[model samples]
Target chain A: MQVHVEVLNFYARQMRLLDALDVEGYAGTFTEDGVTDHAHRGERVEGRAALIAGAKLALPRYAGAAVRHWNDHYLIEEVDENTLAVSYCSLVTRTDADGNVTFEPTFAIEDVLVRLDGELYTRSRTIHRDRPAAAA
Target chain B: MQVHVEVLNFYARQMRLLDALDVEGYAGTFTEDGVTDHAHRGERVEGRAALIAGAKLALPRYAGAAVRHWNDHYLIEEVDENTLAVSYCSLVTRTDADGNVTFEPTFAIEDVLVRLDGELYTRSRTIHRDRPAAAA
Candidate 1:
């Protein structure tokens, strides 16, 4: 069995937008009142605008770092006909100035996605960090 | 929408077994041939027996730590109606001997689950740690 096409596309777009630092585009992937929980950092931000603001602040930290995100694999469970619970592994890497590559960070993301008006948007995201923010 | 009862039960049993430090029981959650990728630790353990051995080697690290795991939420995706992809968030807390409690770890896990002979077992697990193990 294979993953749903829409699910794969969603992550692909997300990764592209994030790596490109398209903050607005990336934030657009969520609902207007979506929520993101960065549990490892003890951070929670709700509402699309606020999520955008948070990303705006955080994404810059990785600027010029050549960070790339890979939402490598996912498992999906249908919550209902209109909603899906999607979980997957997120692997991140960075290329150094000297062209060396190192593993930056990796974790799992548990997200709730709803199909509204025939389009899918993330309603909530909870990132489980195997590595914690405090430790960093 | 709600998570499937059986899927939820699987996690419940796995969690119960793990917190109890029941290595054999915990390993039983996996199929006879299962894969556990502790990538951050550079550990790739295969087979139920090896998984149990790995648990034996690792569980003692938390012997006196009063550790507990909470799997808060999950997203499920179905593949062929028999195999499923499940992802979830894990929050771990450790209390000291004095009863001081602090949130120590949070992470996400992505797993491949297969239904076999009217039962479900974990086939593969890939954990993404927000924090890297090398630093820990």
Candidate 2:
């Protein structure tokens, strides 16, 4: 499979696990010692265990809604034979039981993916929340 | 150059054209005798000319807002050497100048695409508005 398609499919599966609140499954998409840097919040969580812990704590915020991450404008680069640098814009939506939908602020994300036995897994991810331009 | 990746890239470009309200440019993404069937509205437009005309008429509706179609769950099937059947769920949003966003009803769309001169173009599109399940 092509790298672009592989990367996209990886995200499709990873995001579904996340939105479904399958914390362990979501963490499985990353390397054992993967790092996630919340650049906007200046918080970095390292390793799959930490990822699972953080995700568990965040679960309550989505207790009664279906949260989805819609991503676009993917830019992927081959950093080496087995490494990829990827980035995209993400928009999140939460749909309640009544089917009303609400949005979260947009975000930009970058990641480093490495091939493990022909499958891709995230080695690192950095997320930046989108903000309006400051007045000059 | 996998089919799945190609189809996604095609949509990324095509949706941009539609959202940007580049009527002619958008129409150009279809074949000369393409067809658009708005199943929910019972409108079937045939040919590039008709497509362009219908789009132009709808342009006024998007005058002040930037409309975007966020699509998910793309399913692609190769029907022949140069033909593909594709389907996906689409979520539409319109962002106003003030940055507030509103959504249109969700839609499920199926499309037939043909490859001509190494590029893909829509030959037929059928769009169905998603509706709640009818009471039993």
Candidate 3:
């Protein structure tokens, strides 16, 4: 399979696990020492264990909501034989039990993915909240 | 490139043209006699000219908003050597100048895409608005 399709498919599966609140499953999509940097919040989470811990700690915020990460404009680059760099825009939505939908600020995400034993896993991710363009 | 990647890239470009309100450019992504069936509204628009005309009529709805269609869970089936059946869920968002986001009802869309001279184009599309699932 081509890197573009592979990377897109990887995100589709990984994000589903996260949106479903499957912390362990979601963390499994990453390497054992994966890192996630929330640039806008100045938080850096290192390792799958830490990732799961952080996810669990934030689970309560989604108590009665179905959360989805709607992504677009995926740009994928093959960094080398076994690594790929990918970036995309993400718009998050939370639909409550009563069918009311709310939005979190949109974000732009960059990820480095590596191939391990022919399977893809996220090595690192950096997220930046989107802001309006400054006046020129 | 594989069919999966080709289809995804086709959508990325097509959606961009659509969200930009470039009605003529958007219609050009379809075949000369392409058809769009709004199943929920019982409206059928046939051919590129009709598509452009219909889109122009709806342009005023997006007067001061940036419209976006965020799609996910693409299922692609090769119908034959040169045809593909694709389906996905779409969530529409309209962001006003001030960045307040509003949503249109979500939709499930099915499309038939055909490869002509090695490039893919939409042959037909059917859209259905999403609704709450009924309890058993």
- DockQ winner among the candidates? 3
Q: What lDDT does model 1 reach? A: 0.74
Model 1 ranges with Cα > 4 A deviation: A1-26, A29-54, A58-115, A118-136, B1-3, B132-136
Cα lDDT tens digits, model 2, A1-136, are: 4778788899999999988989999999999999999998899999999999999999999999999998986767899999999877677889999999987666668999999999999999999765433221
lDDT of 3 by residue, B42-86 (tens): 999999999999998988787866677888899999999999999
Question: Candidate 3's error at B85, in angstroms?
Answer: 1.4
Better of 1 and 2 by TM-score: 2
Candidate 2 per-residue C-alpha lDDT over B78-108 given as tens digits, one digit per residue, 9 for 90 to 100? 9999999999999887765555667799999
- Give model 3's TM-score versus the native structure: 0.63
Tell me the tens digit of each residue's lDDT in model 1 across A1-136. Answer: 2237667656755665665567789888899999999887889999989987887777646644455565656789989988999998876665434434456568889999998898889999999887655854
Looking at model 2 chain B, which ten-residue stretch has the lowest summed lDDT?
B93-102
Predicted complex 1: CAPRI docking category: incorrect
